[model samples]
Target: MIVERLIIADNQPLTAYAVEALSRSVAQEIHIEDLEIAYAQNKTQLNNLLRDGKKTAVVVDYTMFDFTNQENFTIVCDLYQNTSCWLLLSEELTPNFLRYVVYQTQNVGVAYKDASLDSMREALHYVMTGVRYISQQATQILLQKAAEAENRRDELTHTEREILKAIALGKTTKEIAADRFSSVHTINSHRKNIFRKLGVNCVHDAIKYALRAGLVDESEFFI
Candidate 1:
């Protein structure tokens, strides 16, 4: 798909010029509006610009702090519904935060500001096709998000959660039952359910699951 117009929005002067140059080959085809400030910083300006421009893809710096991740995402989502968003990321951004961004928008691309122009081109090329483009670091962040989501899916019921934590604390079934005023048989049943839900077989495996799921502290492993 051809990008009818490319809007380069950045607070940095030199970076904006460089982006204009990089997009020259494509920009020459129709129009490429280079903004001297962060568009996400000024919603009114962005809205007005888009209202008059042709079908466009916004290449912007993701460094503006005034808007939150969700807010930024709302803008991205709104743009993606009609156009596209190509983001220039910041080194200071955490991987978890990036995962939240990925969760918000699908047809988007992002690269660190310090990345080479080739990297930027690669990102732009894919996002122009309505594909998700991201760096290796961003990939790792997405993987971490996936792993965390899996842990959540394996989450325990309230009673099962308590039993899981108690096991992580090195408590035996009989001891846990006494602590909770439950019978040994009831405790054993909960343990069995926990194992089945977590897809683990033994107490040790269950403890590991609890630790990964953040149901217990790492120090509890030694206890």
Candidate 2:
């Protein structure tokens, strides 16, 4: 079993279910916790998590908002460079967005909110093994997109790459912290660098740049 150091951004029932499922089947050493973040918190709970040093992968609800913007996404890319992450989206994802994320955080994976435990389990396995995972329904649509071949030569540092992945998967700084082992302040520092290096202001722009730069390849993306 894989030992996943996990975090949850949403405190909903399904988040609990997903965590339980992962703990039961996929992760041998599962560390499940929650980050309660409001716009007014002194330091977002999620950021505190990211600041921690232990490198652990994260699974997050797609609806969480802290790392919703481009800056925050870049921050996550910087902080959790070695971590793998999963985004449980509210609905089906578009091909363009999917391709963008594939480039931004090369290790990001996607699964629908309604996906089975086994599916999530398999996805985690794939990501940890250095492969990308997209749901079957999203596969053909993602491949159908007009894609540019990836240029590994322009690859971001490993850390920047992971932050990009977290953003692509729709994680916030607060969410990112809870999902991985990093601090909020450190996460923010990485954010600044990610924007500077990628030369983009928001998640959307960064993703587009990553795609255009040949940072991601659609053919290798297995949805």
Candidate 3:
């Protein structure tokens, strides 16, 4: 795959310089031409650079950029179908941010700003080839979050799990009580316990947990 333009959308001078150098090395190895540093301070500039619809690879640090949120960055990425991104993350980035962006788009490659030169090169190569790459540090964050979520699911009792699933399936407390041959108060008590055990305050949070834990399928939720 040929990369028509390489855009470095970072503000940090040191890291941006490193990224540019590494990008140049990779570009030479892969024969990518027209490499230029397009410092897109905001979404508009970034959009203008990618307006031509050529196959462009963007190396960006979204945290430093003017994007309001990760979703906004994703919106820009989605707008440019021919553009791929390499997210140069900071050490302070949260796992939720990583999870949201990585899952929300497939054309993004993730690596830390402080990542090794080799890893950054690999990430750029993957992005240029239209393949997703998650650096070792980012992969650990995702894995750890998944494990913590799994452990939280394990804290729920079997009965609480059933009640959680029922709630996620949109069953009312009265309906669950009737189905289980129990009183409404009893069902309500189960709901409270389910929320407490899941460390959630509202039914919505519990439902999200249920969905993530595979306690209920998304289609079943709609049905």
Candidate of highest lDDT: 3
- Candidate 3, 40: how far from true, in Å? 1.2
Predicted candidate 2 versus true structure: per-residue lDDT over 27-132, tens digit per residue: 4433323422122122266566756644544555544545565445545645666653444444555554555556666545677766776776776655434456
- Model 2: runs farther than 4 Å from truth? 1-4, 28-43, 83-89, 127-132, 147-223
In model 2, how large is the Cα lDDT of residue 132?
60
Candidate closest to the true structure, highest TM-score: 3
Of 1 and 2, the candidate ahead on TM-score is: 1
Model 2 vs truth, CA RMSD? 16.2
For model 1, which pairs clash? none
Model 3 score (lDDT):
0.77
Please state the error at residue 104 of candidate 1 in Å.
2.5
Clash tally, candidates in order:
0, 21, 0
Each candidate structure's TM-score, on Cα atoms with residue i matched to residue i, is 0.56, 0.50, 0.77
Residue 162 alpha-carbon offset, candidate 1, angstroms: 4.8
Across 4-81, the per-residue lDDT of candidate 3 in tens digits comes to 677878778887777778778887888766565566767788888888777777878777889898778788878875
